[model samples]
Target: METSQTHENSIKLTSTEDGIHLDGSILWLDSKHTGDISFLSNPQSATSKLDSRVIATEETIRILESFRKKPKALICQYNRPFAIGPLNMELLPSGVGLGGASLWVETNNKKILYAPQLQPQNSETCHHMQVRKADILILSAKTPYNADANISRKREKERLIETIKKMVSANERPQIFCEPYATGPEITKILSEEGINVAVHPNLFRILKVYEAYGSHVGSYIQHSIHRGDYDTLLKPIPQNKQLRRVFPKNPVISIEDNQGPRLDDGLFRKIDERFYIPSSCDGRELKTIVPKIKPREIYIFGPYAKDYVRQLRSLAPVVKALFPRHLPSLF
Candidate 1:
């Protein structure tokens, strides 16, 4: 076993660089070019109640506008390695979203895997699980309380199905709230197969259409048009091999919720009140299962967790809590 002296020093946060650690020192990972730059959603839920309650401030709008002005294309061609500064970056598909990726970085004879939310429960390829020989592995965790990551996706799916089936049997029209950007399509696919019609939010519908237009697998079972239009225009019947079905008469032909305030169920009809929300966030247990395989020299924990939980994780490998604000720019 290695001691603290052998382990890499703590990652430092700096203003100039986005948080990345290099040569055992914190440095910025540049996003201006393709080298050492990749995309992963922040650990926080993009669509949460608090977010729903508040409108974007001017600063928020400006920040978002800045991103739109200079958007970097993150290549998601699986298993293909691209150069990222000092690292040879490979984008691996994480099943959590339409095209979300788990970045595997290789540089200077070291393998560093950065997966703030690497989920492998539903994937047959199990790319996240395939990660081996990582010198430093970065993971996202559900804090305060440990994540029940031990629960398999199959089990989660089974549980969800059973719950929905029971609700349907009881004549309850359940509305499954899903993250617009990420897991909506996945959940929709599962529900549709069970002959349950899903009323998708417009945001999610648009994302699915983009995937479908590009012929992505996530959009295969998700029947929707890529044409940009309002709710009524999108709902209007269009010719397709897979005919769309209506969830309710008043709600129109193809199932879609209108863009309105984020009341959890924005456009969903009142009858569809029973909510079956899907929590697609990363679980802490993911690391417990992964650490033994990669056997990394160091591990960085991102996201929230209780102090005791962090202490317990010490036995796993050299552990460090990645405090985003404090440890701003870390490169490895």
Candidate 2:
């Protein structure tokens, strides 16, 4: 095995054919890693958009094969942990959306945290629950470099509300195009409680329906339509009360549609003076504050974010840029 020990008790991680090769064991981080591009048919429609990028589902689930060794335990309630070879690999749940996991590998009493894509909402209880001290930390470098990372979820929610209010005052009802998976439902939940009319694309609505069945209060407010004005085949499950009907007419309506057209440079986003806000969870600036708390001994950054931009993290630990080939199985 190829190895690089840059720090005491540190080991360079590497990609293996089956999983991320750590100390005497292999850890599979994602659900599947078949590297099958053909499964990504109609790339735009099949995947969730994170800024300009799209993550296809079929590509995500490389295949339906079972794990060579099933997970032996669950972590933080949502994550899965497996004992492989000499290492204990724990899959930590991501805060970005409904389902994703970051890898936490341990071997020889050394702990390594690998967060390739993580953007937890500040208000989420699990946000702080995921943080832990580690010997090595790996982060994705593909965050919006220019945007301030410290922007709190509360501030963003308030900014969105303010933007929508300004649009309503201008006598325009805003139609929003929301990515089905890239964006979380926090903002949508707030808009619903404010009595704003919110409609979602049928496909996206179906996903929210599942969330509703699971007892999510916000799912009750999302309508199964492209917009309030559009025709919908699905019958409204709940009886519409007079007060509920009045919300759409009295307030500027917000619609969540799956990509209807090609995305512009900024993609579907908040336009100047426009009545919509496209919320994406791709921003990683929150890490600037959170990582210091974890206080890992060494850090590796892997995404499109520049090395210089992540250098600010050096103050917390020894930071390094480790970009791996797309097809490579591991980063060490």
Candidate 3:
């Protein structure tokens, strides 16, 4: 493992085979090393390593339980400090998705914050990301470096609402496809608040209920049924097979997804009348704006465009490192 240091602080960052280690004790992101406790930033981050001693929020554990079996973790709540041996840690909401959290640690009189999946702005289903001044700030560059990175959530929601309304006006039932956890609940809540009746797939409905249980006002939505044609919009998880088309064969469908198109099965793409891209995460521009507020001495970024983000954020912090993950897993 190579170590780097800045003049002001003796903070040492070691990139090991298991994962990045802070001061040779705390690990970030990965949990393969048994010697160090893993701080899972979100439910998706905990999917692969369930047996580890993970520090996550109660909402994160509940969201994980909704899809898979219970995990072995020390459940904590937002803004509450919990002790794990000599270290004191707190879980702060990351605003990336349902139950997404940022890990804040205070050890040896130094503060470290791991916020790899941050949406600092207000979200419909998730808590707004809470950031704190830290000696080291480990952030995420998940949003690509492009024009789409500048799009605001409010604008995206407005466009999505307009698209859905247009589809309804055209007598087409808009069947939107999104990740069950990420944008599905938010989109459902947005449409519901707009007074647009939405019917959700069973998979999405299950996660939506979990969001509502945690005080997210997802509003009213019915489970999609072939016999029920009462909804103006139908929201389903990205189809893995031709099942989506088979279920809504006669209804004129307009497919809506994030920047990444729905990974639909072969030949199933032709059935949709139109498609729209609604971004879920903050863009590079937003990150540039949010990072300065955190006021970290050093910054480490991990995600899709980590290197590019490092260049963009270099001016914000004294030291910026693009610490891309060895293996990038799906956020879902």
Worst 10 residues of 2 by lDDT: 36-45
Q: Model 1 RMSD to the real structure?
A: 10.7
Clashes found in each candidate (C-alpha, N, C closer than 3 A): 17, 7, 0
lDDT of 3 by residue, 117-140 (tens): 667666667888788888888776
Off by over 4 Å in 2: 1-9, 15-24, 35-81, 123-129, 144-146, 149-153, 165-171, 182-184, 222-284, 326-332
**CA deviation > 4 Å runs, candidate 3:** 1-9, 14-19, 26-36, 46-49, 147-150, 239-277, 325-332
> Which lDDT values do the candidates have, in the order given?
0.44, 0.44, 0.70
In terms of TM-score, how similar is model 2 to the real structure? 0.62
| Candidate 2 lDDT by residue in tens digits, 1-332 | 22222455567554332223343333433313323111111112223321212122221222111112222222223344656467666655545444344557678888888665555553231232365578888765544443444544466567766666566567656544344443434445666666565665455565555444434455234455444563211222111121123223333334321112222222232222222333333344557767776688787665445364456566777655444444532312
lDDT of 3: 0.70
- Give each model a TM-score: 0.60, 0.62, 0.83
Query: Model 2 misses residue 116 by how many Å?
Result: 2.6
